[model samples]
Target: MAQEQAGRVLRSVKWRADLTAGVLATWPADPRKRTSQEWEQVRTAIPGGEGLPSSVIKGRTRQAVTFLNANGRLPVDVFELEGAPRVPRMLLLAACDRQQATIERGDTDPGRVMLRLQLPTRVDPHAYGDWTWVACPISLPPMVPVSAVLHLPTLRVTGRQVRADVAYTHTVPKAKRTGHTVAVGVDWGLNTLLSAGALRLQADGRITALGAGGQFRAAGVLAKQHRLRRLSERLHAKADHYQRLTAGDQQHDLAGKHAVLSDEIQHVSARRANLNDALAWAAARWAVDQAIAAAATVIYVEDLGSMEAKGMGRSLNTRLSQQVRGKIVDRMRHLAAEVGVAVVTVPCTRPERGRVHFPVRRCEPTTSDRPHL
Candidate 1:
C-alpha cells in the first residue's frame, strides 16, 4: 500500500513537471535561476498543481532545474517511471505522526522495524483526509550500528518485495590532513587488481615500508566480465545491422530479432553492473582490512583520472578502459570512513615509456628504528 501510494504521488509530480518543462522551454529567463516565488507562479500555471503537495512540487521543480543546469535542456517524456519513490524527508517521519508515512521500531522486538503509511481508497482524490493508516513490518540489516541516527529512506519495489534505502548518521574520528605518521600506499594492477601496503614517516622525514601487503585476485570474475562485454558488443553490432536493414520500418522481417537482441543486451548490462558492484565492495573491504591490520591512519592512492588506456595493446587497452577503478575508489572511501581512515589520492606521473611513478619521499635512515623499503 505504501509503494502504491508513493508511486501515485510520484507519477502526479512527474506529470506536473513534464508540463512545466514544456512551458519553461519557451521562457526567455533561465529556469535554473528561478526564485521560489517565480516557481510558485509557474506552478499555478500548471494544470494539475492543485493535486500535488506543495513540498513535492517544490522538490520536483528544484530537481528539474538542477537537471537543466547540468544538461542544458529540460527533461521530456518524464511520465515513464519504474515505480521508485523519492519521498521528501518531511513527509517520511521517523516517529509516530499523522502524516503521510512513519517508520518506528517494534515494541516487542527491538530488532524489528515497522513502516506505517496512509493510503486512500478512492480512485482519484485531491486530499488524503479520507485515507487510512496501515502498518507493515520491515527488516533492517544487522550491519547498521545501534547508535546511528536514522533518517527517512527512499523506497523502491522489486519483484514481490519493497526495499527501503535507509540513510543514517554515525560519529567517527576525524581524519588528519597533514600530520600523518603512518599511511597505506595503493597501486593499481590488471589481474592482481590492487597492491597496497603500509608506510611510516620517521622523525627525520624518512619513509619506510612496513610489510608486504596482500593482493586481491579475481581472475574468474574478470574473465566473465570480459566475456559479457564481448557478447554485448556482438549483440549491439547485430542490432545495428538489423536497424539499418529495416530503416525505421516496424514491419520489417528483422524487427523481432533486433528487439530480442536489445533485450539480451539489457540483461547482459545488468549482469555486468552487479558483477562490478560486488568486485568493488570486495576490493574495498580487503584494502580497509589491510589498513586496519597495519594500524595506518590514511591510505594514499595514485590518481588515475587522467590516465588513458591507449598505447597499450588492443585487448589490454580495452580491459584497462573497462576496469572499475572509479567505483573502487568510491567504495574504498565509504568503507574507510567508518573506521576513521582517510583515503587520499596523490598525483602520479607517467613517463614516455608508459611507466607510472608515484610521488614518494625517499631518504636514507640514520638509525635502524624502522624497516627500510
Candidate 2:
C-alpha cells in the first residue's frame, strides 16, 4: 500500500517537470577512414578541461550522456573544420541512472539523483559550432522513462543528427485535475471503422456513446477492395493465357488485359487511400469533438503496442495504417491543445484490454462494449 501510494505521488510530481534529460551522442559520421593514431589524438582532444563542467566530462564516458553544460554554444554548420567539432558534449541526466551519482535537490528523478543545472533549448548560433571535439546538440527530444511498456518497446523519442546545440525542457504537468472535466475513450477501426464514447466523471461519472459510423460505408469499402483485387488477378491471369497462345492471335488480347490490370490496380489504390484518409479524419475529429462537448482537458486512448490493432501478422497496408494512427494522435493533440485539452495514452493491461483501473475506484461501465476495430 505504501509503495503503490508512493508510485502515484511520484508520478504526479515527476510528470510536472519542465523538460527531459537523455543521451547526446556525436559519432564521426562522415569519416573517410580517418587513421588510428589520428583517432587517438582526436579522442583525447575531445574532452577539453578548460572551463568545462566536470559532470559534462563524466557524461563523455557513459553510453547515454547528459548536458551538464558546454564551453560554448557553437555554430552547427562548421562541422567541416579540420580539427574542430569533436568536443564530446555534456548532458544533464534528468533522472536516476546506473551511475549512482550524487543527487541534486530539484532535479526530476526516482531517488536522490544528482546532476547539473538545467540546459537551455536555444543556443547562440554565432557562439556555437567550433572546437575539434565540441559536444553539440543532436536535434532530438531527450529520452524519457516509462514504466508500463511491454511486447514492443514503448515508442521512444529519438535523436536527430542535424542540430548542434543540446537543450531539453520537459513541459510541466498540471496536476490539478479539472473537477468539471470529463474523459472520452477512442477505438480505431481496421479497414475504416469508428467507435467513440465519452466518459464523464464530473458531477457523476457517465459513459455516453458519442459517435459511430454506420456499417453501410464500411461494408461498401470492404466489398470494393475485394472486387478490385479479384478483377486485377483475373486480368493478370488472362494476360498470361493470351501470351501463351499463338503469337499472331495474342497481341491485342494480351495488350488489353495488361491495360485492364493496370487500371484496376490504380482504382483499388485510390479507393483504399480515400477510405484511410476519411477514417483518420473521423477518428481525430470525433475525439476532439467529444472532448469539447464534455469541456474536458484530457483524452485517453489505448496504449496500443506499436499502434497496431490486435490481429494476425500485419501486411504492408496494415503497417502503413498503423503508422497513420500516430499521425492522428499528433493532430488530435494539436487540436486538443488549441482548445486547452491534454491527450494521454493509458496502457491496455493484458488481462484487461479495455477497462481503466483507478487508484481509489474502478468503473466497469468504461468497458461496456467490446473493441469494434
Candidate 3:
C-alpha cells in the first residue's frame, strides 16, 4: 500500500518537473534566478496543474531550474531517475496529524516508540482525508536523547520498503576556533581512505605528535566499488552502442536490449550509491572515535576539491576520480557537530610537492597505530 502511494507522488513530481522543463526550454532569459512566486505563476501555462500541491510544484521547479543551470538544458525525454523522489514535508503533514505520539511505556522501551505516518491513497499531493495511517515502529542503533525534538520526516520508497528519514535537533556546546592545545589532522589518500593522528601544540612554540596516527583502510570495500564501476562502464558502453544502432527508432531490433541495459545500469548505480553511503558513515564514525579517544579539540582535514588526477595513469586517474571524499567529509562534519568537535578543511597542495599542507606548522609522519576498517 505504501509503495503504491509513493509511486503516485513520484509520478506527480516527475510530471511537474517535465512540464516546467518544457516551458523553460523556450524561455528567452535564464530561469535560474526566479523566485518561488514567479515560478508559481507558471502553473497556469501547464495543463492539469490544479491537482498537485503548491509546495511540490515549487520544489520540482527549483530542481528543474537547477538542472538547467548545471547542464545548459533539460535532460533527454528518455532519462530515467537515479533514485526515488522525495515527498515534500508539507504533503506529509497535510496527510497526517498527531504524528508526535509519545510512547506509553516511557523512553526506555524502544519497541513502543513508533512513528505514525499517513500515506495518501487518493493520489493527490494536496488533498487530505483519504490517508492510510500506518504505525511504523522506530528502531535505531544509537539511542535517542529525551531532550531532542523530532521534526517532520521525508519519505521515499526504496525497492519494497518505505524509508522515512527523520531528523532531530538538540543543543551542543559550540566548537572553539582558537585556544587549542591538541588537535587531529586528517589527510586523504587513494589506498588509505584517511590518515589521522593527534598533535600537541607545546607552550614553547614547538609542535609534537602524541603518537603514531591511525589509518582508515577500506581495501575490501574499495575493491568492490571498482568492480561495480568497471561493470557499470561496460554496461554503459553496450547501451550507447545499442542506442547508436537503433538511431532513436523505437521499433528497431536492438531497442528492447537497450531498454534492458538502461534498467541494469540504473540498478548498478543505486547499489554503488548505497555502498558509498555506508562506507562514508563508517569512515566518519571511526574518525570521530579517534578524536574522542585522543581528546583532541579540533579536526583539520585536507580540502582536495580542486585536486587533479591527470598526473597518474589512466586507470589510477579513474580510480581517484571515483573516490567518495566529498561524502566522507560531509558525514564527518555532521557527526562531529553533535559532539562539538570542530572539523576544519584546510587548503591542500599538489601531491607532487612531496608534502601535505597541514594547518599547523612542521608536522611529523602519521602514527603507526592499527588501521580501522
Candidate 4:
C-alpha cells in the first residue's frame, strides 16, 4: 500500500510538469482566436495534455498568446521538463465559477476564509480517494474587487505550504485646489542645497513675502565627497603600481590586484551615488513641505538648461556633476503635485537691451555682485 501511494505521488508531479509545458507550447499564431479549434490541435500535439480539461487548456493558451502578442516575444523562457527544471506554481484560472475551487467563511471564525481546491482526478483516479479536496486558510481585504487569483510557492523547511495572491483594482479621486493664490521662488545653490522664498504676487506689480527664507542643507554631502576623494587617490596609486610592474619583465600578479582595486573603487562610487540620491530626496521633500505649509499654489524654479560645469576647477566640476540638480527638481515636482501645487520652470535668461523685468525675484544678490567667500 505504501509503494502504491508513492507511485501515485510521482504521477501527480509529472502531471503538473506536463501541464506547464503544454501551456507554453500552445502559443497561438493569432491571439484573437484564442478559443478556436487551433488550440485543440496544439494541445493534442503535446504529450499528457490530452487528459487536461478544455477550460484549463484554453485559459493557458490565451495567457501565453496574449503575452507573446503584447511583447513580440514570450515573457519567460519556454517551459521544459528535462534536466529536472523548476516547475513554477500553476494558477488554476476560472476557479470559483467553474466549481474547480470553493471559498467559504470558517465555522470557528467568520472573519477567516477557508479555500478548497479540486485536483485533477483524471491523471490518477485513486490518488485522493472519493473526495479530492485540498483545504487552505486565507484572509482577504474588505470590499476589494478581486478579479484574479494566483497560486504561489511558500518557503517551507519541512511540510508543504501553498500561498494564494488575490489581484484587485482600486481608484483614486482627483485633487482640487484650495485657498488663495500663493507662489514660492526656489533657487538651487552650491553652498546651500535649496533656497526658497514664499510670497504672494500683488495686482500692483509688487511681491509680498508671506513666509520667506527657508533653506535646506545637504546631509552627508561632505562625507560622500571626502570618501570619493580618498577612493580616487587610492585608485591612482594602484594604477601607478600596476604600470610600474608592467614596465618591468619580472612576473607579477598585478593584473588581479588592479582588477580587485578597480572593483572596490566602483563599489565605493555606487555607495556615494546612493547616498546622494537619498539626500536629494529628503531635501526636496522638506522644501515641498515648506512651500505647502505656506499655502503656496505655485512653485517657480530656474530652468538650468544653459548652465554648464565648464571653466570650474576639476574638484568643483565633479561635485556639481554628481549633484543631480535635475533629479532634485523632478522629486520636488512630484511631491508638489500630490498636494495640488503646480511647479513651473522659468528660463535663466540674461537681461538684454530694454528687457529688465523678471518673473521671479532673486532672494540673494548675484555672485558677480558679491565678493568671493
Candidate 5:
C-alpha cells in the first residue's frame, strides 16, 4: 500500500531521457520499412505526436539490417513512443541514419527524430580521473522514442521525450582570499571571441584590461584548415594516378581511388580534432592561469546550461558549440579544486521560465555600477 501510494502521488514525464534506449532492446527489425512520407504519416496520424517518450533498442552488440534491399547496410532498432504507459504506441524506424532521402517535402513528413538509445557506452573526455561516472544498467531508467519538428518556425516540438538528465549544476560561492586577489573579467563576444584582462581586479577593486589589441589566434587556425584542404585534394589526385599503375591489365581503379580517399579523410578528420583540442586547452589554461594570478582561492564562472544562452548553438562559434563547454567547465573545476581553489558557476538565468541570461560577475564585485564583463 505504501509503494502504490508513493507511485500514485508522483507522476513524472520520465524526464531522464535514457529511457528510450532501454525499451528498444527487445523490439524486432523493421516490420514495414518506412519512407519519408511513411514516417510523416506516422507522426501526424499517430496519436500524441509530441507527448510520448522516444525509445531506442540497440542490440547487446552491433548488427546490420542486411534484410533491407539497399545500397549500403543499415542498422535497425525497434522503438516505442508513449505519453502514458497504459496505452503506449510503438513505431519501427528503419532507415534513420545520417544519409536519408525524401522525394516530396510533404511526402516525407516527420521532422528531426531523436530516439533514446540504450548502449553500454559513455564518454570521459577529460584526461583527469576526477568526476568520471558510468551509467550502469541500474543507474538509468527505461528508454523512449521522440521526434523533434524541424520545418516549422517557433515550433520546436521535442517529440514526446523528456529530459531526465536535466538538473541544476553550480557550486556554492566560498572564496576566502588567502593573499592578494585578482578578478579577471572574460567577455564572450561575436566579433571579438573572448576578451581577457591582464589585471582582472585592481588594488581599489576595479576591473582593468591587460592587452592592447584583441587576440585573433582562432582565425589563423581556421585559415590553416582551409589551406590544408586544398593541398590535400591536389596530393590525393596525384597519389591516386600513381597508385592505379601498381595494378596491371586488371588494374582496379576503384581500389586506388578508395585508398586515396581513405587517407584524405583521415587527414581532414585529424586536423579538425587538433583544432578543437587547441580551443579547449586555451580556455582551460586561461581560466586556471587567471585564478593563480589573482592570489585568490576560488573562481566565479558563467554557467551556460540555461536555455536562452545565444552562442551555445552549433553554428555561431565552433568553440562555444554543442555541449562541449559543460564538459570543459567540469574538467577545469576539478583541476582548480585539486590545487585548493574553489570554482563556482554563478546562475545565469532561470531556465524553466525561459531566461538563460547570466548576471555578469566581474573583477570588482564590491561596486555600485554593474560592470560590463
Candidate 6:
C-alpha cells in the first residue's frame, strides 16, 4: 500500500511539471490574443491540457501575456534549468483570494516573521493533501505588508536566497517654515563647477546679500582624464603589437597577451566612469549642504538646456560636456527633495542693471530685454 502511494505522488509531480512546460511552449505570439478566450482556445488544442487546473493555466497565461506586452515579444528562452531538465524549478503563482501565500509575524518570537506558502491539493492530492503549508523565515520593515512574491532560482550565487519586493504607502508631513525666507542662486560654469550666491528676502521687497561666491570644485577630473588618455594609448600600442606579431609569425600564440591588454583597457575605462560619478555626486551634495547651512528654502539654478558651447574647440567642448553638469543637477534635485528645500531652474539670461532677478512665484521673466547669461 505504501509503495503504491509513493508511486502516485511521483506521478502527480511529473504531471504538474509537464503541464507547466506545455503551457510555456504554447505561449501566444500576439500579445492581444492572450485573453481568456484565446487561452481556452490554445488549451483545448493541446492534448491532456484540459486536465490542468483553470487557476494555474490563467496565472501562467497572464504572466506570459504581461511579458509579451512590456517587451514586445516573448523571452528568448522560458525554462532556465540548472541540473536535471525533467525536474524544473516551478514559478508558482500566488492566489490572493484563496490566501495561498501570506506573511505574518511569529506567535512565540514576535521579532521573527515568516512567509507561509500554502500549496493547493488540486495540484498534488496525495503529497499536498487538502492544503499543505510551508513556512519560510523572512524579515520585513514594521507595518509593511507583502504585496506579491516572485519565485526564481538564485543567479551566479550559492545557497537559496528568497528576495521579497515589498511596497508601502506613507504620508509626508507638511514642511513648517519657521526661519527667515532665504534664496540661493546657482550658476553652472565650465571653470567653476557651481557658483552660488545667497540672498535674504526682506519684507519690503528688498534682497540683501547674506553670502556670495560659493563654489564646488570638481577635484581630480583633469588628472583622471590624463590617466585615461595614457591607458588608451597603451591599449592601442598593445593591439598594434599583437596584430604585427600575428601577421608575421603563425607559430606563436598571442591570444593570452591580447586578452590581458583588452581586460586592462576595460578596467581603466570603468575606473574613469566610477570617478566621474563620484565627482558629480560629491558636487551635488556640497551644493545641497551649502543651501541647508544658509537656511535657504528655495534654490535657483541656471537652466543650460538651450545654452550652446559655440566657438569652443573640440577639446574644450568634450571636457565641458563630459563634466556632466546635468547629472549634478539631477542629483541635487533628488537630495534637495529629501529635505524641505526646493530646487528651481531659471533661464540663463544676462543680468539687467548688474542684478539678476529670479521671479520666485511665477518663474517667468518680468521683461524680455535681458541677454543670455
Better of 4 and 5 by lDDT: 4
lDDT of 2 at 90: 29
In the range 1-373, model 3's lDDT, one tens digit per residue, is: 3454587787877775566654554342445444555545555555665444444444455665666678876644314222455553333332344642222223676433466666667766565567666676766435455555565555667777776565666676677677777889898888899999898889997888989999999999999999999999999999999998999999999999999999999999999999999999999999988889998878888866446555689999899989888788878887777677788877766578676645664322222111111
- RMSD, candidate 2, Å: 22.9
Models, CA RMSD each: 12.9, 22.9, 11.2, 19.9, 21.9, 18.0
For model 5, residues 267-308, the per-residue Cα lDDT tens digits are 776676666556655665666676666554545556453323
User: Residues 1-373, candidate 1, lDDT per residue (tens digit)?
Assistant: 4455577687777776566563454442654355666656665666665444444544555666666777776666354212344654333333334466766676676556777787777878677576788787777678776656655555656436666766667776666556777877788999999988788888997877797767888899999999999998998999999999999799999889889989898888989999999999899889989999998878878777556676789999899888898889888888777787778777666689965443344311111111111
TM-score of each: 0.67, 0.35, 0.67, 0.46, 0.36, 0.48
Which wins on TM-score, candidate 3 or candidate 5? 3
Model 5 residue 199 lDDT score: 40
Give lDDT tens digits, candidate 4, residues 1-373.
2344445557866665566566666656665455556667667766755554554555555566666667786645333222344434445332234355666665676545666766655765665564466777777555332322223212123226544554322332222333334677777777687878787767775777875468887646755666686777788788778867767433666776766777777777767777767776887788778777887766777776546564789877766655667777777765665565666677644556632122643222111111110
Clashes per model (N, Cα, C within 3 A) = 0, 35, 3, 0, 28, 1
Off by over 4 Å in 1: 1-98, 119-123, 350-373
Local accuracy by lDDT, each model:
0.70, 0.42, 0.70, 0.59, 0.40, 0.61
The reply for model 4, stretches above 4 Å from the true place, is 1-180, 203-205, 233-252, 349-373
Ranking by lDDT: 1, 3, 6, 4, 2, 5
The collision pairs in model 3 are 212-367, 212-368, 213-367
* Model 6 CA deviation exceeding 4 Å by range: 1-180, 229-257, 308-310, 351-357, 363-373
